[model samples]
Every structure is written in C-alpha cells, then in structure tokens.
Target: MDQQGQNGLMRTFREPWRSRGALAYVVAALLTGFYVVLYWTEWLTPAAVALGLRSKWLLYGALYSVAMVGGAAYYLRHHGNSRYNRVRIAVNVGVQVALAFLLPLIMPLFGGPEAYLSYFWPLSYDKLWPSTLSSLPVYLALYFIVGSLLVAPLLAYRYGKRWYCSWVCGCGGLANTFGDPWRHLTASSTRSWRFEKVSVHTVMFVAVLTTFLLVLDAATDGATGTFHWLVAGGQWWSVKQLYGLVVGAILAGVVGVGFYPLFGPRLWCRNFCPMAAMLGLFQKLGRFRIAVKKDMCISCGNCTTYCEMGIDVRSYAQSNQSFTRAACVGCGMCAHVCPRGVLRLENAPREQADKARVRLPVVDL
Candidate 1:
C-alpha cells in the first residue's frame, strides 16, 4: 500500500472515536440509560418477573442486548464484515435470550424449576457437594458433569477458549462489547503477565481444594472430627458467604464492571476468574492457536495494542510465532485490528512443534 493508504488505515484504528467504535459507545450508553430507567421505575420487576426472569436473567439480558447489538454494529462497520463476528453476536444474544427469559418462563409451566432454569457455572466447584448432599443431583450434573467435564473439554479441544469466553459467557460478552474501549487499560508488561498467571491459577486451585473438602464433609454428614477442624463450616461460610455472596456478588458483579475505567474491562477475567483458569488448562493442550505470518507483519504494534489479554501479539508476529497463550480469551480484537492481515486463528496439528508452523485457519462463527 502507498504511504497515504497506510497512514489512513493507521488513523482509522488509532482514532477509533472517528470510526464505528464511537457509535458502539453511544449505543451502549443509550441502552444503559434505558435499562437504568427501567430499573429505577421498578418496571424491571414486572417485566422480568412476569416473564419469569431471575436475577441472573436481568444481568444476562442487559449484557447480551448491549454487547451483541452494539458490538455487531461496530464490527460490521470497520472490521471487514467477518462472518465470525456476525455469528458471534447472533449466537450470544440468541442463547442469552433463550436461557434468561424464554426457557425459564416456558419450561416452568411444564413442571420445571419454579424460579429459573438450571444453567451450569463451570467454575462453581463448591456447589457440587452441597448439591449432591441436598439430593439436588441436577445441580451437580449440570455444573460439574455437563459443564466442567463435558462441555468445557469439548470447547477447549475444538476452539480453545473462544466458545465460552468470547461467544457464550455473559462476562466475556460484556468485555467484548461494552468493555472494548477500556481494553487499552490491560497491563502489557511482563511483570503484569507473571502476576496474572499466578493469581488466576491460584484462584483455580483454591476452588478445586474447596470443592474437594466440601464433598468430603458432605460424605461424612458433617461429623465433628478432624474434618470439621479442617473444613470449619466450609459449606456455609466458604461456599455461601465467601464464594457465592462475596466473589459472585461483590467481586464479579461490582468490581469487575465498576473498575473498567481504572483497571481495564478484563480485570476479573484476566486476574480472578477461576473458570478462565480451568478453561486455560485445557486450552494449553488444545490444537487451536493464532498463527502469525512474519513476512506480512509490519511491526505496527496494532495487534499487541488491541490485545485485551496483554499478550505481545506484535512480538509473536514479528518472530513468526503462533500465539499459544493459555489466557487468551479469543475475542479476536488482535486479528481484527491487524492492517496487514498477518495473523490467523487456526487449529494446528499437535505434532507441529515449531512456532513458525502454519495451519488451516478456523473461523469460530
């Protein structure tokens, strides 16, 4: 491309306020206002309860609506109309709508749960034993067997973390769309990366350990012994008070969203999300990767600048290496912002050891 073309392209990416990204911010703001009014007027209660919407549903709906619509609008305008982005928006909105409102309202009439449908939370490990002890085996089945054991591995194998983190998760959906602007806040330093690796994985380990103890306590029917000393009212204090109330409500609900301007949109996902850590474990063994073509790379740093996970994407591209970072949520911002189209997300064979190895591209949409 000519100098003029390169300059224009750079300007379009750098000054996103001059492009469709600004429109997304406007749409998000408008929708947020509408939602706030709906809640302030107490209209959300009727609209939601009448439709059998649970608390989770309200969150899911607002997030899905804003993220999908606004995100799609922005991507369609400036990101070359990729099929992946289009289908990602559609699937995210459709699935959230179904899970949040339609299914909960419809299924209960046929004798489902009186409050809400059973949606699995993959990293909610502490819930497993309580579920089994309460004889609500369904929760165990859904959260552990279906979500953690089955769906997670399948998705990791097929598409790394993209299936959940980018396309389906409410948290990820929020980050991808509403959090797009604040993505630059992600710390790109190697020290930050080291801290991220330790913190998130530590959370995952704690989750697993807590779950194991809870299950053990449940099995013994809460006998007062060494186990009690070890667990120490773990079921109520740890799971209910700490994990459910504190982590779920305060950390994820409040700090995660509220700290967007201060610490980037992915503060939770990048630092404290146990589910991400669990998925990243499987992702390390997955065939999927983002391959960088060094010949096409211009070292413009657009890829790294847009990387929400703080991976040095430009370095990877310059060195002709494939990105195998386990923390990658696969939001596609790096690939989308690349002017030279040097990077591609693909499934390389396991036998391919070299960082420069190329493979057939895979479009997640």
Candidate 2:
C-alpha cells in the first residue's frame, strides 16, 4: 500500500468490527436496543438514579460527552498529524461537551430552563414550535428563532454546512470520532447517491411542512380544527408525535447511531437529516468547494472511501473539476487523504470557481 494518504491500508475489510461481520451486527443490535429502551421505556431510570443524575437525559449527556472524548482520542491518534484535523476535532468535541451537554445540564440548577444552546430548529425540531418557544425564556427563544432562520443559513452560505456539521453539531462530532473506523463502509455507489438525494430532501420538505402547520395551528387558536388535531393535538397518531417517533427517535437515535457499525456513521445526516438538506442548499449557492489540481490525481480511492457523506470525490478530483456538491459536509477528509496534494478546500469567489471549472491540460499548467 502506498504511504501517501493519512490513512494507509487500514485493512478495514479484514476487521470484523469494521467490515460488517458478526461483531458489527452485535454492536448494532446493542446500540439499537439501548436507544429503544432509552426512548420508549424507563428501564434506565434506576441506573440514572444510582448515578445521582436528575434524569436519564442528563445521564445520557454525560455518557455522550464521554464517548465523544474517548472517540476524539482515538481519531486524533490516527489523524492528528494534520493541524486542521486536530483543531477541528478538538473544537467539535469541546462544543459537544460544553454547549450541547454541560450548559443545558447546569442551567436548570440556576433556575433557568434546560436548553440545548447548540441546537436550532428543524434539527432540534421543536425549537421553532410556538408552544416550545413560549415556554422558553425570551432570550433563549429569540436565540433559537434568529439562529435557525438567519444565523444558521447565513453561516452555511458563507462557510458551508461544515461550520455546523463538522465543527459544532454533536451528531457530526460523534460520526467523525466514534464512527471514523467504519467510514469506508459508507455506500458511495450512484444508486445510494440517488436515494440520498430523494430521501434527504423529502424529509426536509416534511419538516418545513410540519413546522408550518404547527405555527398555523397556534396562530388560528385551533380554528383549523382538523389541522390542529392532526398536527399537534397530543395524540400518538398526530403529526408531531409521529414525526418525533419516526424521524427523531427512530431515524436520528435508533438507526443513526445504532447502524453506525453496519452503514457507517452518517446514516442520519446523509439520508434523512432535514437540517443537512437545508444547509446543503445554501452551501451549493455559496463559496465552499473542493478545488482539484489539474493532472495530479492518482485515482486512489481514499477520499471516496473515507467520505462519511458518501461523496464521489475521486470523480471530481480525477476530472480536475473544482466543484461544490450539495451533499458535501466539507469535512476536508478528501484533501487530508490526497496523496498528490491534488485536492484543496476553498471558499473562493464565484467568478474564480467558474474560471477553475474550465478544465485545462497538464501542459497548460
């Protein structure tokens, strides 16, 4: 194996845990079972009490932070030689520990609402709901509203979804860290890409529709009786409850983390995340792109293999096509693993990107 990429011949296929063997299945089963019990049952309540935690959620947060920290160590051990990888992973873990977990845990102690400051609407799902916003403190409500509607999209437009997906989102942090080992398992086939494009945007549309209905119900004071009942009337079959059960619990929790061993870390982000879908739209309209150097690619598969988002990076690199794909999370792994230094992540002006898209022969360079 050539020693050019950051990861050199991991023998991923030879390892049972990484290669979808029996151990991988077992791990997936355990993870699925854990989430099922956590979301649907109070089986873990006793364990949370024994740990002196107020609720199972806090206990889960502690465990989540620990997992990210442990996984970060493992990730850094393998990819830490690059300054970019080290800093990005460190900041990601820090955001998970501090903003996502600890701050929410500590806020209620000071007579404040327990809120995930790091999360915003669509992904947070309930953050934009009128009832949820009314329940929160005014500042926190504004934070979620403004952050979701303005700040988040603006950031995605300026810096790409990586600003959140790679550097701050707990989901992405966990994927990059704990899920790093099985990244090569992410299906990069054309069929998978087509499925991803359809499924992700469908979920995004559903999310927007759900939120719109909830707001309309609240605004009309339930005059839209059927819509109100169907959307948020506290019934199990209601849209809110169904979405929570299907999208939030089943997709995000159960299948997302649980299937990591078999399907790779980004099962949720790549195929189902409404937030990623929305951000990706803004990202495509923005500046972030992976610029490929002409005549430099060696056709090695490292970039495609390690892309958690299932992007066919080698195709773009080999063609010297400096481009932005809506699905790209801008994780920078393609550049990190490029043997010939053929790939670069950039936020250049649209004119420059347009110019670069015109292919040139090696002699012209």
The candidate maximizing TM-score is: 2
How close to the true structure is residue 223 of candidate 2, measured as C-alpha lDDT? 90
Model 2 TM-score, all chains together? 0.95
lDDT score at residue 192, model 2, on the 0-100 scale: 86
**Candidate 1, residues 1-365: lDDT per residue as tens digits?**
23211223345335544333655456445644554454335655656666556554564555556565675565445542566766776676566566644665566577665322223443444435564436544653465556666777778877898788887776776776666656766777877887889988887777677677777776787796766656745455644345554556555656666565455678888888888888888887787788777688998887776777877787778767776778888877788678788888887765455534553232111
TM-scores of all candidate predictions against the true structure: 0.76, 0.95
- Alpha carbon lDDT of each predicted model: 0.65, 0.87
Residue 132 CA displacement from its true place in model 1, Å: 6.8
Best lDDT goes to which candidate?
2
Scanning candidate 2 in windows of ten residues, the lowest lDDT window is: 356-365
- Clashes in model 1: which pairs? none
Q: Write the per-residue lDDT of candidate 2 for residues 20-99, one digit (tens) a residue.
A: 99999999999999999999999888998998888899888888899899989888777777888889999999999999
- lDDT for residue 282 in candidate 1, whole number 0-100: 82
